[model samples]
Target chain A: MNGEIAAILAMDGIASGAIYVLIGLGLVLIFAVTRVIFVPFGDIAAFTALSLASLETGGRPGTVGLVAVLAILATAVEATALVRNRALHRLPRALLFYLVLPLVPAAAVWFAAGTTLSMPLRIVLSLALVLPIAPLLDRIVFRPIADASVLLLLTVAVALHFALSGLGLMFFGPEGVRTKPLTDTVFDVAGLIVNGQTLLILAASIAFCGLLFLYFEFTIQGKALRATAVNRIGARLVGIRPTSTGTIAYLLASLLAGISGVLIAPVTTIFYDSGFLLGLKAFVGAIIGAMVSYPVTALGAVMVGLLESYTSFWLSAYKEVLVFGLLIPVLLWRSLSFSGTEEEEAEE
Target chain B: MKNSIVAAVVAASLGIATAAQAEITVGFVTSQSGPGSSIGVLYDRGMKAAVEYASSVGAEKVKLIQLDDGSDPSAATRNARKLVEENKVDLLIGTATAASTSAMVAVANELKVPMIAISPISVAANEAGDRWAIVMPQPPSLMVKIVVDRMKRDGVKQFAYIGFSDAWGDLVYNGAQKPAEADGLKILTNERYARTDTSVTGQVLKMMATKPEAVLLGGSATQGALPPLALAERGYKGPLYGTPALLNTDFIRVGGKAVEGVQVSAGPVIVAEQLPDSHFSKKISMDFRAAYQKANGMPTSDGFSAYSFDAWLVFLDAAKRAMATGAKPGTPEFRVALKNAIFSTKDLVGTHAIYNFKPSDSYGVDDRALVMVRLVGGQWKYAP
Candidate 1:
């Protein structure tokens, strides 16, 4: 490939990878905290995007913009309510409280941006919506069934999936709506054209990743979150409330998913049914990351994006087949490599 | 409401008293849900308008019963039987999709109720033979032949076919292939994809690799337009060709500027605006557009209005003939009279085209009905 084409491909890969990372992060967060998969994460993203797009603008700010404003206000009220409740009585709970606080700002930005918002706004809004959702889900479904066996939890997740799918159909209609692009500008660099929105997505993904790194490396709450992930009971003994900490982790993951949705909406229009496919891909990305290690998961997402781009370029017709072909082998390799660690965790 | 209820009660009593008496009822079946809802909407509009027009002319009220088949063939068969055996509808008009239409045809033949298909004529029309069935619209194969002939006249030689892998696509291909070959136009590539396939980028790219002068599309409005748009984005400047399906307003909206030069062979609906002498056509076109806009809050496509109008007109003409022949009101004899009248139609001026039905011909094929159009400034305009 020519330099320009290569650059364009690279940019496309990164943008696609960023979307996957956000979705994977949410999945990882929910799984880490609750030991349960949050299947509705993608549905929420699809619903929000569709609802936002459907908002008609007669004049002034549109319905989507108005909804976004209301959502932001709600997030603020909820955050304040949490603070007033003395929700973080324990040190571990306090750490989780701090971790989830960023969600308020993220959601506000998301709502403020609306449908006319740029790619960056989409990323921020998505993250914000998802963050609160993760904790809310933990409070509602997971917490109620916390005492249930793994099999029971899995069954509940399946039930949640069906319910969410139905809800999506009822709200959004069966036909998928194409999302309007943030910008139609195509930048020609060295003979390779890249959509401006894609570049913005890449930049946003890097910034979000950097922020995540800083949060986990430097913040007290971040370290506690990590400690909780390593040994839940041990962390609780060390003054970390595993439940609250897990909720915080889930919130972060949800936020990432929301952001991914935002980024993805502009690139490819979102439908109520889009979430299942995206969620499946994100699960593969997570598994490829060994279902642990944030950096590794993010990297896995990028690789998947690259694979998708190349397959679409070359095979085109059987691009989906190419995706599954890569996913199966990678999953098998990861399973063999992590068998020992899984056995150790089982014994413990 | 009280008076009508009392009258209905009295009528029911009288009807029960005369149980052995014959009754004439018209059954109208169409897709009210699923992917083909648009077609159903058109059918409803056409049938209702025709009924209204007939009533305005002081004709007897033709009891019209409607059944929703939801575009499923099995549902259509069940519904056809219910209309025929249970409801005892003397004449049947409907079954929108190819599958549903075929199933209904078999039921109609078995039940011996004359069937008038209002939707697109399928490939099965060729093998249908001298049965009690007649299609109002031109057959799919003939439509394709006309499209290719028109394109051949325009100096287009090399061609590529892009269509959804379904019965509709098969009909178009079967019709176009022979004529195209005879005209000396080389077929560069022929590619088919599923209707639900989001991206036709692969199929399009493969076709583009062959570098054909023209691409013929045989899919629904959305599917027909997208691949062309993708081709335009890839800098392919060749003419995009399509069947009547591409004449829809949705195609223009979705395809945007990319569809500007695309040519399609459609019925007379799109060209109704250009026909200055035809007052009936002008009025139907105007009223349809206005009603559709009022109902859906968006401009209705020509296909929806034209198809619906033609379907209604066919029924109205038949009903009038039945009334003229002195067939007893609401009897099986009246239904047969109406069916025979429809078959006897020689040159009826319609909103789309003049329909001529013959008892000897199993399928309806009106040679004068087809018109070729192109997407010009976001609307279908006369191509040549």
Candidate 2:
């Protein structure tokens, strides 16, 4: 292959790898803080993509309905908590924040769905619908089992993935939908064409990931999350609400997944069950980071993207076999290098 | 829902028991749920329309039973077994995919139930099939020949192939090779991918590096839509070709303008209006097309619907003659009679092709079964 063509292929690989970086950050954050595998990370991303397509078609995204249902359930849970604490006056506040909070954006989406608004506003509204899902699920399902074993949490996460995908099928119908590209400009760079979408993805990934790093380094809540990841009992003993930390981790992770989904939809057709594979690939990248370091995980994910691009060209039929085969050597080397981290089993 | 379905089944059985009548039972096992359901839904609509036509005209009464395989081959086999053993269906119709159809066919032959596959899962009339299985869809060889021939006429000789990593992909790749070699065309690269793959950028780049004259993508339904879109995004400007398995509206709808200028071989029923009046499939195809539109409330239809309609016609014609021999449908004698009748079919016109079956070739459509189509202006225009 010519140097220019190879340069473009590497760029394409980096573009795809950017998505994996977003998803890997989410998986690692959720796993470190909450000890949950976050198996449904990819499913939510796929749903986010479909929601944008639905908005583009002027139909209320199925996620708007999901947000409303989750809002109602969360309100009930908070109401029950208030009654047990004998804080009767706080019921309306709980109801307003939990139930009414979601409705405003959902209602805006409902109104704007069929209108020919600019693409950016519609995408923001689609993200508005998907962003709340992680926090709601963390509260309703994961928080209850917070003190449980990692194996149980992992199994439950897997089950949730299956349930969400089934519900996705029912809501979205059995059709694959593609959205218009955010930008159609193709720049001629060094005699090789570069897609505008690829540049957008790479820029957004770096900006968001950098913001996340700053948030953790400077903010009190970020330190609380870091402390919880380091030692949950220590954080709780220091008056940090471990539950809220878990909820925050979930919210950030979901935001990453949702944004990744909207960015990905234009490049490929999105379906109800397509998320599982994407999520699994991201998990593979996170594993390469030892599921703790953010930068390393993102780096590993980009390598995955480049490896996938080059290998598929060399051996098209064995692309998957080779892609998955990458994890074996990484695991072996990590195991040999970090033999002192045997407390991995005892900590979880 | 399960209770209600069982209640309905029981009530229907009671009604049949009181009437003391033997009804022809035909079981259909297809992917009514899961990723393959879109293709299954179309075949279901078309087959139901055919059944309505026969029932309204007062042909031999048929009791249709269906089971969902969820696009799983093992599930299809289980459903076929249940239909043959528990439901006692004399004839079986199933499966929109080649792999699931093979599973269903194995069960049908083992149970001695006459069967037909509505998709391009070709079943040769061999002793292994026990003369009990046949396919109604156009052969992959016949369909791929049209694309190769159309390309040959346009002075194209070399191509690249990227297909699914399954039976459907293998069929198109192997089938396209037969006519391609005859016309002195070379396939430079052969790539494969799973239907559920999130991207094919790697494969598209490999294809572009080789610089073939054209690329042939063999994906069924909307899954086939992905590769062309990816190829276009990579700025690979060459003619494109596909198989009859991609003859669905979803392919065009999801593929968008990127799929414009794509050429393929499809059943005449897809572009029935464009076919000449002298064409053999024109009249029957027009009738079938009208019925499908009336049933679906949509003007567009594809080879998926036509295959099942042709399967239904063949089944109805055979059931009519089999019933005349005083064979009760729930008996083994009825299945044997039906299989024999299917084998005896000759010159029976269908929406897709003429049904001419023999002991060794049950899927008996010749070159007339397929036509070349080009996607121009987001429409499938007849190219020949």
Candidate 3:
């Protein structure tokens, strides 16, 4: 490739890599904080895209049903907690948080169905539908076994990913849906035209990273999440409820997935099975950071995207095999560097 | 005593007549309940409609027992074997993809039962055994010939190729190469990708760098639509040529406005109405559409559907010929007779082509079966 093409490919790579970073950030955050690998992150992204497609067609998204179901289940858990603790007087607050809050978004979604809404409204609605399920999933699947080993949590995450994919296929058929590009302006930079979407993607990624840094460094909830990530039990001892902290982290992570999906949908086709590959690529990026460092993981993800773009030009067939093959060497290096690292506690 | 003997003979003759008139068992193996099912459902139902139409027109009773292969070639082979061994189907038909079609072809040849293809099994005439198997759709070679012709006519000199990293891609690329090369056009680059690939920017960029005058996407249906859409997004302003399988409505639906002005070689059934009145396939294609719509509420938008429909029509004719020669539906002799009758078919016009099955050519379709079509405003228009 010439210099111009190379530059353009790099831009394309970084644009896509931004999406990977969103997913990678989510994966790393969920893994570090909750010890759950968050296997369904990509699926949630695809679900978000599909919901946007549904909304664009003036139809209610099926994800609204998922939200309502999760809300009811979470509410029941809360109600049982209040009743069993003999705290019936606090039932109203519990109901308001668990029962009423979730339905508001779902009801808004239902009322918004089949009405020609602006693109921004549809995007927000998509985010609103997807954001709640992360905590609901945490409460429903991971919370009961929050103290369990990482391996068991990983297994549960994988199972949830598989089930959610099957549900995605049932909800949205086996076809890839592409939404319109958020922007159509193409510019010729040194005789190489770049899509406006690419620029928007890069800008959004930087902005999101800045916002996230601010949230974690300045916000009290963010500090609680960090404390939980440091030590789940210690956070509880320090009066920071790990559940609420974990829930906030999940919400942030899921929001990233939702936003990434909507942005990436214009660039590529998003299908029910599309998430696994994207998720796997992000997982590789997370692995590169030893699944800990956000800046390192984001940088690694950009490198992965660029490498994938360049190699696919020369060896298109083995591109995936090569990209995925990076894992072996990275794992070997990590093992050699951190030989004294303790493995996750095995489940009984 | 003589009159009693006459009565016994009459009763025995009636029994023989009923035995000869038994419902002809035909097994259909297809990629049902799997990734290919969306297309498989259409082809399967299309054949079902053809059988129903034949029954309405008072053809010999036929029992089409379908087996789902779940999109695996091995499963399709097993289904083919089970149908022949357990169900005792005299004739076998199946498979919506070339790889699985190859699998079913082997079993059909081994079991010595006549099999008809509902999809393009292969492009080579050598693969077609004399009396065992035949294909209904225009082969990939014939279809690609039209694509190359159109590309040349449109003044494209350099061709860049991208297709599925699988058998179908290989078939299309290989088939497209010979004619394309014969025309003295340079093939700048060849890229392969999986059907489930989310992005083709890398490959598309490579093609963009090569700056080919035109691009050929060697894929079928919705999967085939990906590259063109990607190319359009990347602002590659070259004509896009596709295989016959790009005729499906799903291709149009997913491809959206990106597919407009893209040229594809497909069966005349796709643009049946647009085909001239003098075309051989026009009348039969409309009839097949009518039968398909009458049975199912949706119109037949895919030419692959007509493939199975044509398969059933040929089977009906072959079964009639076999029955005339004193063959019974369940016997091995009946299968041999059906095979021979199929081999002898001449000048039979169906939805896709004028099929003249011979000992040398099982795929009896000609250029008449295919039309060069261009996407115009989300509709396939025949390019004269």
Candidate 4:
């Protein structure tokens, strides 16, 4: 490919990579705070996009504005619930609690928005509806199960997966539904063709990463969350309520996931099962990041996305085989590396 | 309490009286769920409507025992057994998927019951050894020939093939290739993708690289949407063609403006507007649409339902002929007489085509009617 074509392909790859980064960030956040992999994170994304796409009237307000408003409201409600519970000390437990609570409201909003709206509106509505859902999930299913075994928690996650998948099927039906892009502008700058929506997604990823980094570094709560993540007992002894910090972490992760859904929906139409594949990809990205370090995880997601895109472009039919084949070896190496560290940490 | 007792007695007596009267039972099986449910819905609606119509015209009431096979071939076999041995159905009609149809055909031949396949006609051809199996809809191969012949007539020389990487896709490609090759039309490229794979950009990119004059898509509307969308996105403005399976609203919903100018070979049911105005054609178009929409929330597209309706008409006409021949109204005699009458059918105008069945050619190739339709304003408009 010439420089111009190469630049165009690179731009497209980056734009696609941005979506994976956002989704990966959400997975990392949930895993970082609660130490539980939220497998249904992609379902939240798919549902949110579906809701947003289903909410469009002939000339009604756009999905972004509606989603922003809903996100603010959900954040406020979840924050209040955390305060009332006085269980702010156990940040991880609280985070799990908050993540499970929002599914009901999310489903309700999805149903209400589904009947009247156009494809774009439904997608936006779905995104807006799911913003609070992650925190709500933390409050309900995960919080009570915090003291349970890791296997039990994993089982719960699997159960949640089934529940979410079933609920999606019940609501959306078996066949996949398509959504229109939020914008159609494809910009040609320096021989690089970038879709307007993809550019926005990239911008959003950068903005989110920057904002999150700032929050974790500068804010008191951010430090508390970090301390809690590092050592929950030590953080509790130091007067940092780790539980509340975990809740905040989960809420932030869910917000990122909801936004990711909104962004990805425009590029790839949201379907009920779209999340399973995305969740698997996000999980792989998180694993590549060592399930810690937001920047590393986000970068990992981008790399994986690029790998996928390039492989797909180059190999066409066997792209999946190439990408997945690469994943197995990487995962085995990571497992071996992590096992050594985990043994050292235990001995220390 | 007294009224309830009297009503129960009346129901029991009526049931006994109906049981006393000689009755013929027909079992119908089709998909009620899964990805292919839309076709199943159409089949169910068409079967029910035809049966009701037949009942209204007949002296003896015909009972339809229905079962949902969920589009699973193995489940279809189980359902076939249930309909045959358990339900003791006199005749069996079923299965929307090719695999399911094939499985049921085996079961029907084993059980020695005449089976009418309501789905694609490809399965029937695959199991041509089964003498009892009759495909109501003309085979995809025939449909492919129709499309290629039409394209040839229109002076198209070069073509591309983009189809689902499944049995349905293979059937269309296999059928279209021989004719296209015979007509001196060069096959520019052929690409295939799994139905579950949402993205078709790579396939479209590969196909466009070959630069064919026209493209033939062999998949359902949802699967069909991706290639056209990718083609449009990549600025490939060649003529797009598809199979009857693409004649669905979902394809337009997904493909948007890209669906425009794309032509496909559709069954007579979808291209009913092109057929000459006749009582049979108009009634089939109007009544089938209304009844299908009423039974199922969504409107029915082209499927076995049209053939099922035709099958019902053929069955009734045969029954009337049998009665005319002084055959007894009892089950065995009625079945034998009906089978003989059906075999003797000639020049009978039905919904799909003119039926003329013979013992030598059970499916009656003359009944096959195909038309090319173009997507105009998100609706299938017949292309002459």
* Top candidate, metric TM-score: 2
In candidate 1, position B30 carries an lDDT of 88
lDDT of 4 by residue, B113-213 (tens): 66667766543322445355556776678778888877788788898887776678789889888988888887776577655453565566566667788
Model 4: per-residue Cα lDDT at residue B332: 52
lDDT of 1 by residue, A162-280 (tens): 76666555445545555566678888766665668777677768888888889888999889888876766777889998767876786677666666666566444455667877777
**Candidate 2 C-alpha lDDT tens digits along B72-116:** 888999999999888888889988667899888888777888998
Put down candidate 1 lDDT per residue, B1-384, tens digits, no spaces: 999999999999988855533334678898877545557766776566555444321334557789899878899999999988877776788856767887888887776677877766542332445466777777787778888887799799888887766678778887888988889887776676544343455456667777888888887665466677668866789888888877666567667788887877877666766755543456666665565555555655556545655666676677667678877644667656766887887667676677777776745545557778777788677754
Interface RMSD, per-candidate values to 1 decimal: 4.7, 2.4, 2.5, 3.5
TM-score of chain B of 4: 0.83
Model number with the top lDDT: 2
Candidate 2's TM-score reads 0.91
DockQ of 2: 0.49
lDDT of 3 by residue, B1-384 (tens): 999999999999978865764778889887766556776887887876786567621455677788888778889999999999988888898887677888888888878888887776652333443458888877778888888878888888888999888777778777887888888777888798776565677788888878889899887666677888779878777788887767777688878878788888877788889888998888888888888888877777777678888888888887788888887777889889998999888888888888898876778877777778889998788998
Question: Where does candidate 3 chain B have its weakest 10-residue lDDT segment?
Answer: B122-131
**lDDT accuracy of residue B275 in candidate 2:** 85
* DockQ metric for all predictions: 0.13, 0.49, 0.34, 0.20
Residue B307 lDDT (model 2): 77
Better of 3 and 4 by TM-score: 3
